[model samples]
Target: MSVSSRPDGRRNHPLSRPVDVLERRVRIGIVTVAVLGVPLAGAAAGGAAYEHDRAVAEAQRDQWRRTAAVVVSEVTPGMSRGDLAGDGKAGTAQVRWTAPDGRPATGVAPVPPDADPGDRTHIWVDRQGRVATAPLNDTGVWAGSLAVGVLGAATAAVAGVAAVAGVHCLCEHRRDRAWEREWDAVEPEWSRRPHQGG
Candidate 1:
């Protein structure tokens, strides 16, 4: 009687094939994690930048408020002043005016670019009956925008990394499964085939 040649040439246990496939999948997952590391770092950096910009705006707003008080204390009832000018940073505003006491007074405040001229002007009479001018500074809106931009960029970067990693892992898993199934198909033939006597 003739003996059929084993399809696989070597016998392999059915359970071992599946185990090998699972091991390869675990390796793919590890690689995915490594690939995503760079984006995660970018997300952290973006978050930090957002926080720093927010803190700076807040500090600037507080300083603007103090300057406004000085302006209000220097304005006189009949004193004429030109439109306030911002130093282009932290919404700093400078107003020129003459006090009711006939003294020239200059006050700096924080004012938004769109602030109404009337609202930006404050007249306060000191004990000496001298007028003062107070201007308004609006920095909250700009500060908030800075924070939002930074955070949004960070979120997008992190999400992109996760998506790429997920796709890579899925592809690896599919490939590994196909290889395992091909090996399994030939495995049973090896076990069932007859062995020739030596």
Candidate 2:
């Protein structure tokens, strides 16, 4: 990759054109940033998500509790909050339970799909006596953090690929134009010379 100059002190190789040199540098910088920055951004995103989610989980754990509840109505298939509904098997049920304050509370809770009326099932509730889901466990928190990290990294990688492709497209267009300009300069001189068919 040594560059040579013509008699007029201009670069002799087409690749050494000013625009080409700029494009090459831009490509190297983009690749370097993509390789180093994407992982760092993903790790940062993961750490932020973990810390935020962990804090919320801790608060929820402190304010909520698990208690025994007797189902007052048949637990039918219905959407429940959080990941409970994600599994597609849990159902909603009307339940009765005593709060920590010794006050009776009645609410709908998510129960197993097989729960029937009068069945005793465990449920979680918040301090305000509202039916609630359990706080996220440690594994859930880590999984959420990992998902955020992976998404961030994937997005960055895609952007990097797009940038590289755009740069290459521009370089190709410039090279084509340069070839046309060189041909235009040589065609006249070549046309003046006589050619033998033999």
Residues 1-198, candidate 1: write the lDDT tens digits.
444343767444454445454555565665566457545555565556556656765554443332122333222322133222234432334454555556666655444444443444443334443332233234443444555655665666566566656665776687788777776776667888654332
Estimated TM-score per prediction? Answer: 0.29, 0.77
Best by TM-score: 2
Instruction: Estimate the lDDT of model 1.
Output: 0.49
lDDT per residue (tens digit) for residues 56-142 in model 2: 889988998889999999877866783431455688889999988889889888888899899998888888777888678888789
Pick by lDDT: which candidate is best? 2
Off by over 4 Å in 1: 1-138, 189-198
User: lDDT score, residue 101, model 2?
Assistant: 86
lDDT of each: 0.49, 0.84
**Model 2 per-residue lDDT at 88:** 52
Clashes in model 2: which pairs? none
